[model samples]
Target: MPYRKYSELAELVEMMSMAVTSGRFMNKLDDGTYYNLQDSYETFPVKKFENAKKSYAQGIEEDEELLFLFDITLFGSATDGMIITNKKIYFKDFLEDPECIDYVEIDKIIDRKISDEECEMTLCHKGKATKIKIPRFQFFDHHFIQFIAGYAEILQQNNHLLAQGKAVLKDGVDNITDIIFDAFWNGKKVEKIR
Candidate 1:
């Protein structure tokens, strides 16, 4: 049986290709008006995040780590934002307060094309649904987001297959010749296909 070790959440964030800037520079630009995920590394602005954290996250569980933070902001105003962590995810919007869910609790990741320029990702848990507007950063970034939406499922399947002595993850991983992201990326074919 094969197993992969996860040392930290940043590894997954990198897998998603999320553009996170250390707060040292971006903060001077935003002038620290708002906070981004804002970790110890100052991934974004952190000075204001403490307040937001108290209002929203209130600190995650001991073993949990924040993996991603996305907010739909226009001219610096945010209607909502989402935070993905090692164990679960949290969402907060104008309609409601912050909500959290475990990774395994996610039942499906539904993606829909809204138009030539827009698309949305929906996470369905049990019977309820939460929608996230995929940020258009580049030509193919959305696919990574789509994959991140199913991180739990992907890891589970890969580990399960490895436990069964299957090397699908290895084969795909070998195709990449990398130590990480073998299970998540499978191979470069995904990039060529898209």
Candidate 2:
């Protein structure tokens, strides 16, 4: 799916009922794609992972697009995962209450590379900083850090478009590539698909 819309968070969580055969958990992005897996993977019976979706989706805004979500704990407790929208980052720390940090309020983000598999990000805002350890997909492959650096601008653009009642379309993440003479190569510039 290039982009997914769920009226309720439960709808989104239900689709993620599939058991990962190769990866630990599902990670998704807004560019109309998901990393580490695809749509065809087999699913567990709906009853298997149903109720926990409620706890997970509690903090999500009704109209905000869920740009990314990742499971971060062994138990699907109150503090089990993190979500990133264009406006803010929502996450939970172990045994802590669900929290939200708006991008517009952030002053800085210090990303510490823990390893190739994961990282620790300290979100500094309102004279306080909260550190959250997250997966490494956002570093090289997903451009998450790049997005954070520009989210203030992104939020401004979104608000401007909203004020004008205009729609917005975002680009997805993929290796920039080209086919020249029937051979594949990384392209220097990103060109429109059409």
Candidate 3:
């Protein structure tokens, strides 16, 4: 069988869409505040959050649509945002747009701290370190946090196996993909194999 590059991306989009639509997403806005997933969109005002508002207005422009998004703010100002598409994750700075990171580019999850009030995480990707702070109830309390890290590990494995051989890659990747899909779609427990 020939390697289908987009197959994994397509599968991921499906899995992530389930996570979003099922209300299993953890949404954190600016100001270190938390909202129930049900109230996620309420944080965005049309004039202030221009990009995010545009995304909402356009409505599913791609098959690889946005699964989850975070308005990354500094000192009560929305300067950047995190957008999770079906394929990759992006840290979009309003001043300059840089390339996003794929699963394979994510080196490791450096640190994660969850307190009663908020959660903070550090990730090293592509030799760059990034810090993310959000309310504990938004991310740490739900499975979406697990999905983000888990998907990266799985994607790294999938790419490695694909580089090995088509036959070997299919079996290894499908197994992991099935497990992850079931966890997100069927409410199955994900084995933290990595």
The TM-score leader among the candidates is: 3
- Expressed as tens digits, the lDDT of each residue in 163-191 for candidate 1 is 66774545532232232343333322222
Which one is best on lDDT?
A: 3
Off by over 4 Å in 3: 1-50, 53-65, 72-80, 92-99, 138-143, 167-179, 188-194
TM-score of 2: 0.50
lDDT per prediction?
0.48, 0.43, 0.51
Candidate 1 TM-score, true structure as reference: 0.53
Order the candidate numbers by TM-score, best to worst: 3, 1, 2
Residue 61 C-alpha lDDT in model 2: 67
lDDT of 3 by residue, 1-194 (tens): 23323344335435555535544333444343222222344443433334543433233235443444555555433335555554566554446543356656777776777777656667788779876555444333334455567678666766675676643434565566665555545546554342
Q: In order, how many clashes per candidate?
A: 0, 2, 0
User: Which one wins by lDDT: 1 or 3?
Assistant: 3
Q: What lDDT score is found at residue 9 in candidate 2?
A: 22
C-alpha RMSD of each candidate structure in angstroms: 8.4, 11.7, 8.1
Candidate 1 RMSD computed on C-alpha atoms after optimal superposition onto the true structure = 8.4
